[model samples]
Target: MAWGAAAILFCVWTLPFAELTGTSVTCTFSEDCVLPCTFKASSDEVIHWNRNNFIVHSYYHDADDLEKQDKHFEGRTSLFKDQIKHGNASLLLQNCNIQDSGQYSCHPSTTQGAQESWVDMKVHAPIRSVNIEKIDEEVICSSQGIFPAPNVSWTTDPPTQSDMLNNSTQTTQDPNGLYSVQSKVSFMGNVSDYAYICSVTSADGMQKWKTSMRQQGGNQLPSWIIVVIVVIGIGIGIGIGIWIGIWIWKKHQTEKNRDGVGNPGDQVPSGAFIAPGHDHVPPDEFGAEYELLTLWVTQKLTMPGTSQDPSAIREFRGPLEPSLRPDTIVSVTGLSQQTSLVQVGKSPC
Candidate 1:
C-alpha cells in the first residue's frame, strides 16, 4: 500500500510539467517583441529562457542572474520582474533582428513543481516600397529590405505572351539577412502602346507592393532634351523677328528715295535735278511741248547758282503760255476721263 501511494503521488506531481503547450510569436524587425510563458504561482520561483541550448535570460534568488547569457543577446533581453510572482515568465526582447528567429524554450520551477513550454519565433522585414523606372529601351523594377526572400514579376496593360516578357531578376542578401530584389525587362515595341507594372511580394505571401508607369504618346523625353528644344524654338522666333524688321526698314528707305526725300548724305548726279513736285505734273496739257520745257529747265539748272536758288528757277517762265485756251483744255478732257492734272503755274519744280 505504501509503494502504490508513492507512485500515484509522483504521477500527480509530474502531470503538469508533462502536458507542455506550444505557441507562435511573430516579431517585426527592429521592434520589441515578447515571448509568452506562464506557470502556477508558487514560492522559491526560478525562471530560465533559452534557445538552441544558448542562455537567453535567467532569474533566481528574487533577481536576474545573466552571467551565462549569450553574447548575441547580451543587452537585448529582459524579463517582467514584477509580474514573475504572478506566474508570468514572459521574456521581453528589444530590437529584434533576423538572427533571433527560431525555437525557444521557457522553464519555470518552484517549490510546487517545474514546467517547460515551447515558443516558435518568427522575424519578418516586410516589403516596404517598390519602384519602377524607364531607361531608353529597358524598364527596371526594384525593392529593398525584405525578409526570407521576395518574388518579382512584370506585367503590361495590354498583356502579352509570357515568353515575350524577356526579363531577368536578381536577389541579394545583406549582412543583416534582409533581401533586396531588382529586375529588368527589355522592350521591343512602342512604349505608348502599353503600360508596365511591377509587383514585389514577400516569400511568405504576407506583404506585397506594386508600381506602374506608361508613356502617353511616345517615349518620354529627358529633361535636358526638352530644355534644348524650348531654347531652340525661342531662338528661331527671335531670328524671324529680326529678319522682318530689316525688311521693313529697307522698304521704307526705298520709298524715301522715290519721293525725292532721301538722306542728306546721298549724292545726286550732274544735270539731274531733284524736282520736289514733278510727280504731280499733268502730261496731257503739255503734249509735245512738255519735252521742250523740260530741256529748257535742264539748261538753266546746269548753270551754277541756279540750282541753289529757288527764286532764280521760279523767275524764269517757260515757252508755254501761263494761260491756255479753254477749247484746248476741253479737247484733252474728252480723251482722258480719269486723268487729274495740276493747274498751270502750280510750281512743278
Candidate 2:
C-alpha cells in the first residue's frame, strides 16, 4: 500500500494534476502563521499558493504554473520557501491587518495535494491618553482604554525626594481572546510634576510603549504660623509690662510731693537758745518768779527803763489800794498807821 501510494504520488508529480485535494493550516495575529500541505512523494516536487480564486505564487523548480494566476493575489502571497523545500506549501503574510484575515490555499503543481490556512488578525489597541491631577496636595494618575495596561511610576527632576510608584490592574478578556487592563497611581504632588512616566510592555517584553504627565502647583504652610503668633504675643506682653512700670514711678513721685517729707519748713533746727545773764541763774531760775514775769509780762512790755533806771521803776507804782482811782498807782514801803490820809488836789494855773 505504501508503494502504491508512492507510485500514485510519482504519477501525479510526473504527469499533470487537475485539482488539489485538502490542506491544514493555522494563524495568529500579526505573527507568522503556517499553511502545511503534504504529498506521498515530493523530494524534487515544487509547490505554489493561491488566495481566494487568485493564483498568488508558483514555485516548482522555477517553472510557470499557468493553470493558476490572479492579479489581485500578487505581492501579498508568497510560498514559505524553506517549508516548501520540505513539501510544506505555507504562505507568510507581512503586516497583517484585521482585513487580511481570511482563508488561503496552497497548490502544488509538481505534487498531488491541496493545503490551506485560516488566520484571524487582531490589532493591539494603544493607550488613548493619560491624565494627572492634584487631589488635596496629592497627585493621582489615571489611564484609560489601553489594552494590556501600562506600568505606572513617579519620578522627579533635580530629585528632591525619593519617588514611589504603584499600579492597579483590571483585566477583561473579549470573546476574540484579547486582554485589556487599567491602572492608577498616587504620588507627591510637588515632586510628581518633575517627570513622571507610564510604560506599557507586551507579554514577551520585546516592544515597549511609554507616556508622560505632570502634576501642577505645589506650595503650602505648616506649623510655623503658630510659632509666629506665639512670638507676637510675647512681644505685646513685654510692652504692657514696661508701660505699667513707668506709671508706677510717676505715682510714687506725686505721693512724695503731697506728704511734705522733703520740705525745709516742716523740720526743726538742732540747737538751744540762751540769754547772757540767764546762764548764771540757778537751774531753778527757769521756774522763778522773775523768769515767769519776764516770760509773761516783761517780754511783752515796751518799757525803756527796765534796762538802766531803778528810778524809772520807782516812779512806776507797785500796787493800787481799793479806794484808789482806776488809773492811780501806790507804794507801801516804810509806811505807818497814819491818823489821816492825805488827798492830792489838782493844780491850778
Candidate 3:
C-alpha cells in the first residue's frame, strides 16, 4: 500500500524527536536560564531547537529562524517571547556561560501532529579559593577541588583555647606530596590569635568561600631564671658585710671601760685613799681634858692650811680613846679618829 504509507510517515517523523521530555536549567555567573519545553501545539504550530545536538532555534513558516549555533552560543540564544505564542517552545538564555551547560530539546510542528520537550542547563562559577598551613602548634584548614560539592565551615576570632574541627571532607598530605581535600582544624598554643576561616556553600545554598589565616607565636622569658636571681643577690651582699664588722668591735670595748683607761689622760693615784669617821668624846673632857685636847688638835693640823682641805674628809673615825683614871698619862700617838697628836696641857687626871 505504498510501502506501508512510507513506513507510517517515517514513524511520524521520528516520533517528535524521540518523545522529548526532561527539563532543568540553572545558572549563576551573570545569571539567567530557562530552557523548559512544553508543546500541545496549535496556534499555527512551529517550534524546534536542540543543543548538544546542534540546531540553534526555529519557528518555521511564520519565519523566526536560527541554526547551527555553537560558536560558544554566539550572542547567547533566546526564545521565550510569551511562551512562543502558546505553543510554548521555551529557551531564553542570556549571560549564562560555563559552556551553556548540558541537555536541551524542543519540537512542536502543529496542525495537530508533532510535539516534544526537555531541558537541563546549569552554569555557575563563583567558587573562590584558599588554603593555609602549619603543624605542631597547629593551624590547618582546606577547601578541596571546590565545585558543586561544597559545604565547609570553620571560623575563629578571639575564641580559641583548644579547638578541633572536621567537616567530613578530610584527606591530607602536603609539603609537596600532593593529595588534598580539606576542612579540618586544631588549635591551642595557649590561646590562638584571630582570623581563621573556611566557608563554602553555594549551589543555591547561599554562596560562600573564604579562607583567611593568622597564627602568632608564643612569648618567651627564661634565661636560667635570670641567672638564679643574680646569684641570690650576691649572697645577700656578703651577709650584710659581716654584720657591720661585729657592731664596730663591741662599741670599742664599751668606750675603753668608761675611760679608766689603758691609756688617754690617766691620773688619780696618790695612794688612792677613801674613808671617814669620828669617835664620841665629851666625858666632860676628862683625863686632863683629853690630854690638853690632843695637844690642841694636833697643833692645829700641822699649821699648813689644814693640808689644803679638799674637805679633808677621811683618814679615820673609830676606836682608841682611853685615858681617864689610870694615872691618865695619855700619851697616845697620832690618833686616826679625827686627828689627835696628843699633849697640849695634860690633865693626866
Per-model TM-score, in order, reads 0.64, 0.29, 0.27
Q: In candidate 1, which residue pairs clash?
A: none
For candidate 3, the clash count comes to 5
Error of 3 at 195 (Å): 10
* Candidate 1 residue lDDT tens string, 1-349: 9999999999987774533789999999999999999998898999999999999999996999999999999999998888988999999999999999999999999888888999999999988788888877788999888897899988888887778888999999999999999999877455576777888988888777889877568666766888899999999999999999999997877444333322444332222322223432345443421222322121123345554655533212123333322211111111222222232222322
RMSD of 1: 10.5
What's model 3's TM-score? 0.27
The per-residue C-alpha lDDT of model 2 at residue 33 equals 49
Best by lDDT: 1
| Tens-digit lDDT string for candidate 3 (115-155) | 67767776755555667765444456665433355566776
Tell me the spans in candidate 3 whose CA falls farther than 4 Å from its real position. Answer: 1-18, 23-26, 31-45, 48-92, 96-107, 110-112, 120-125, 129-150, 155-212, 219-349
TM-score-best of 1 and 3 = 1
Q: Could you tell me which residue pairs clash in candidate 2? A: 23-115
**In candidate 2, what are the lDDT values of residues 235-312, reduced to their tens digit?**
999999999999998777644432323233221211111222232223342332122111100111124544344443
Task: Count the clashes in each prediction.
Answer: 0, 1, 5
When summed lDDT is taken over every stretch of 10 residues in candidate 3, the lowest stretch is 268-277
